[model samples]
Target: MWNPKATVENALILLLLTLSVMAKTVFSQNCQNTGCPGLKECCSSWGSCGIKDDQCGFWCFSGPCNLTNKSYGFNYNVSAGPRGPIESIVTPSLFKRIMSKVGNNCPAKGFYTHHAFISAVKSFQAYKRTVAKREVAAILTHFAHGSEGFCYKEDKARGKYCSPSKKYPCEPGKQYYGRGPLQSIRWNEYYGAASIFLRLPLLKDPDRVAQSPEVAFKLALWFWTTNVRPALYLGFGESSKRVDGRLCDNLHPNDTKNLVNQYVNLCKILEITPDEDARSEISAFWRRHLSALMKRCASTRASIITGRYGLSFVR
Candidate 1:
């Protein structure tokens, strides 16, 4: 009548077949024909993901794409470090405004007169090539200072004594001539930056900066990352303003916007963007060096944003 053994065997075979089909469906579902969101999908026909090239696919997430699995087709790691706090605070629109104001206007001629500026640019290039964050900052600081008056010619007696000065000294005004990225001026700043950041005895001999531009360039990087950055980002100089222009009571609505602009301009020079993913990396760079100043100073955040985004008051 009823063959129980045969029926059981048939049922088992059917179950196995169903399980195999289900497994195939699940495996196929891992990848899609179209590229996944947040990830640059490659080989839609093959159901792969990754950067545009024919390399392996990367796992896609909501916020940022993970590139760990991808092969080394590209040279640089687009996403390797933590994003900075400035990313959230700064915006694209604000950065454009800042760059517009601080347009690259240094002279392209005169080697002797433009030596400092040239050195500053070279220092920046070195930083980019090396990815030395502190060095990059120092060079920028030097640039900021040099841009103002590092090698400017001042009239001694309002054109009456236009033949340079012996008392005032024709050898580059110390206080007024801080030109470079971070705008470091005064012997104190230069020496301090050199000593602390670059670990050189530049403070003892101020002429070293002019005499040895390479050494000065390295010192400049140190200063911007360590000193100037702290003063701008985490210090009470610019970050703590309230609406009424007081620490608790003073605030400028435009201040935040302005700071963002400055950051964007810096990004343009450095070729960085303020996307959500990139924010952490940039912030980490700022936080590591400027920790003490940021903690001690209240308005450090505001100052940083303003320095990068607002009118730099270089002159």
Candidate 2:
């Protein structure tokens, strides 16, 4: 009876606002399923849809035109897989050596000694082989480069350490001097590489390197595929040679040897022949691991597409 045009415009505006709010609510829920596809739940799980925060436990990325595309959660499946046989073969000897360094109580602190490190590597291999469906060599390559900084503090504090370089000083006040099977550190090299590859803010908060091992590993893998591997290929003709140089030059000769031993342990765990040469052995190991990892990622993506679009599940 009054102004029909004005009323229609107001109603449209309200409808748009309501739709926005509803969409926001739907994307903010937590991802309950561990098996959920790539980042479907990571962005929303942090309590605000598409809101990126360092402490949110996920990395969000938007598409061209600023449309939200996806978020990535920390990968923890690396810790899963077959361990018994690998542990039985490598644990006793590796543990004896590690205990001599970090002490017998190291495992209680979530700080894996050398033997524990080997066990983890083997477990990771198994995970890649079975669940991730990625190449073992690629996985091993990721692991080797990613595991760099775990022992830096322990080595330095005990007077048995050498610096990666005087130009890049180690900050003792920082608890995450890079420890673990992966030599992950808070250095610019790692952080920068991770930022670019994972599209995450790894460099902004250095503490995540220590506080979250799974996150650290994800960063490591990202760096390896995007930067480290290419650099290694350029530096040395053979991938194994590059890995050996990284272990010996970037870290320590002993650390390199220890990692090799871990590789042997992993092979034992996987029931595969442990290649004699340090470079070849790890190269083969990672090749197998990467194969599985790629498969896992593909599977995860497929599930997400199916679920989001209401398509029939493929796997």
Best by lDDT: 2
Over 216-314, each residue of candidate 2 has an lDDT whose tens digit, in order, gives 455544434432343221211122222221221132334434444554554554555443233445544433333222222234543553345332111
Kindly report the root-mean-square deviation of model 1 from the true structure over all alpha carbons.
Answer: 25.0
TM-score of candidate 1 on Cα atoms, chains taken together: 0.30
Q: Output the lDDT of residue 191, model 1.
A: 46
Worst 10 residues of 2 by lDDT: 60-69
TM-score per candidate, in order? 0.30, 0.34
Give candidates' CA RMSD values in order: 25.0, 18.0
* lDDT by residue (tens digit), candidate 1, 203-249: 45554554554554455455444333332322212221100011112
Q: After superposition, how far is residue 221 of candidate 2 from its true place, in Å?
A: 1.4
